[model samples]
Target: MAERSTPGSTPGRLLAPPSLPDGAELVMRVMPMPADVNANGDVFGGWIMAQVDVAGAVLPARIARGRIVTVAVNQFTFKQPVSIGDLLSFYARITRLGRTSITVHVEVHAERDPVNPQLVKVTEANLTYVAIDGLGQPRVLTRQV
Candidate 1:
C-alpha cells in the first residue's frame, strides 16, 4: 500500500502503483516461470535483472539506429518482490543521450491476483548503452529523433 507517485508513473490504488509516464513505452511483458522463482517462492531478482537489461535496450537500440550494447546499469531499485503467476510489464524511456551512449530509465510493473487484479511497481532502473560499430567499437550517433 502506497500513496506516493512511482517516480515516473501516475498514482493508483494502495496495492496498485501509479501508471507509467506518457513518454515511457511498454517494451516487454512476461510471466515468471516456476523455474525462475527462488527458494522463497518469489521470482529471483537476477532473472528480473536480465529481463530489465533487455527491456532497457529497446529504446537505445532504436535511437542508435544500429547495434548497441549495455555499458552500465546506472541505478536499480526494487520497489516490490515479483512472484510466479504475476504478469510483468517492462516500460522504458530515454533519459539522456550522448555521442556514443544513451541512458534510459526502465520500470517494471506486476499484475497479480487475476480476479481482484493488483498492479504494483516491482522494480525500476537507469541503464546506459553504447552504440557499437560492426567491429564492436563505439560509434557516434548520426541523429537524435
Candidate 2:
C-alpha cells in the first residue's frame, strides 16, 4: 500500500472552509505568537474571544463617538483549533442598535499558508457593547445623521 496525504496535511496550508456571504468587511488581522499559546501548545480561546470583542466594538464606538464597554457575548462557537503562526483576521458588522447598546456579529478566519493566503473561518460570535460615559457609566446612544 502507498501512503497518501490529505490537503491539510501540509504544515502550513489550510483546508478549504465554507465561503462567507457577499459584502463582508474585514476588521482586523493578528498573528498569535508563542506568548499567546497555552502549555498544551494551542492558542488560548479567551485570547481569540477578546480579539473578537475588540473587533466587534470598533464600529459601535465610532458611532457612539465615545468610550464603550463589552456588556455581553451572546453566542460564541469555535469551529477549529488555532495554532501559533496562523494569521487571524476578524470580520464584524453591526447587527442591532439599542438605546445604549449595540449588537455586533463577528467572524474570525485564520490564514494557514502565508504565501498562498488561504483563509479558514475558525470562530464566530455575537457581542453586545454599551456606550459609556467618562465616568464609566452607560450612556444613551443617539442616532447620528
Using TM-score as the measure, which candidate wins? 1
**How well is each residue in 15-131 modelled by candidate 2, as lDDT tens digits?**
443475443567788899898887799999989988888888777888898888899999999999899988787877788889999988888888776445556889999999999
What is the lDDT of every predicted structure here?
0.87, 0.80
Q: What is the overall TM-score of model 2 with all chains considered together? A: 0.80
User: Candidate 1: what lDDT?
Assistant: 0.87
In model 2, the clashing pairs are none
Model 1: CA > 4 A from native: 1-17
* Model 1 residue 122 lDDT score: 92
Candidate 2, poorest ten consecutive residues by summed lDDT: 1-10
